[model samples]
Target: MVGDYDSYFADRARRGAETSPTSATTEPAKTAPAKPRNAPKSGLTYKETRELETLEKTIAETERKIADIETLFSDPEFYRTRAAEAAPLQKELESLKTGLDDAYARWGELEDKKSGS
Candidate 1:
């Protein structure tokens, strides 16, 4: 009764249907992405991979802060009269921008080395 998947069997047994054959068979085959013909011969070293991951995380966090600052800027009063709020937002925006610049520079350096440029 447990493996019986037919509607009639489920109804008769008052239990859920068994896993469908199609469900088990429906998973897409896993495949690696096609590499460019001129792609780098050497793969990323462990340190480079770790640094890229860390930089990506830092960039994402900085972007989120920028988005928060932008949202705060959307209010007219934020720009006109809310100097205190605007001050912090402006400072944060600058910091995040600097962070983005540094992250991009690091990424560019890593990519140039990887591609033998």
Candidate 2:
């Protein structure tokens, strides 16, 4: 009786259903696209880019000078002969340090404006 009942229901379901072909399936809906993992855009203009490049080059050159000064300071003979070396490098480093501070302040101002703060 159970076998007859099961077969009867199965046959009835198959007969009642309309036979149709399945279409290609698709993935479930997603929330949103992934964001890029990078530093936020500064929205700097062309002039800003040129200024930054110039400042960065100056800073790099100053840093190299500082490194050379340090090397000279380490050597007794060079330290005596190049006593004048440290003064200029120190002055340039201080100037570059001020430039970096100004750049950071400008960047902060830009960021604040962008955030509507």
Candidate 3:
């Protein structure tokens, strides 16, 4: 029955889906530690300080990636020759933007907690 299905229905599995376990040699990606910021206020705990710094770093990285994607989108030649490639990048750009918004919200919450302490 598998062979009888239409191509569209037969290929319903999403592209980029991982189908196998990664090899042992594939080390997990390591991000550099967030850059040092102005020392946290006296009221902030060490854990809170670390979390805020990491959030700031995440926000910065996400914004940079989003800008890079936007620049690519602005170049007409990119779309003209590689429109197929744009869909994945656009999806990634949207995800990054959403993450950035969440990061900003978390940062705000952290700030509020720091102030409340």
TM-score of each candidate? 0.54, 0.39, 0.60
Candidate 1 regions exceeding 4 Å error are: 1-43, 77-82
lDDT of each: 0.79, 0.66, 0.84
Which digits, one per residue and each the tens of the lDDT, describe model 1 over residues 30-116?
899997799546757889979988988888888888898888798787777876778777887898898899898998887877776
- Global fold similarity of model 2 (TM-score): 0.39
CA RMSD for every model?
Answer: 18.5, 11.6, 28.9
Clash pairs, candidate 3, are none
Give the higher-lDDT candidate: 2 or 3. Answer: 3
lDDT of 3 by residue, 1-117 (tens): 355457656466432234324444588799999999996455568897899999999998989999999999999999999999999999999999899999999899888888875
Least well predicted 10-residue stretch by lDDT in candidate 1: 13-22
Off by over 4 Å in 2: 1-42, 82-117
Relative to the true structure, candidate 3 has a C-alpha RMSD (angstroms) of 28.9
Q: Write the per-residue lDDT of candidate 2 for residues 8-80, one digit (tens) a residue.
A: 9997777656442232244557779888799656566677656656766665675676566566667889767
lDDT at 20, model 3: 29
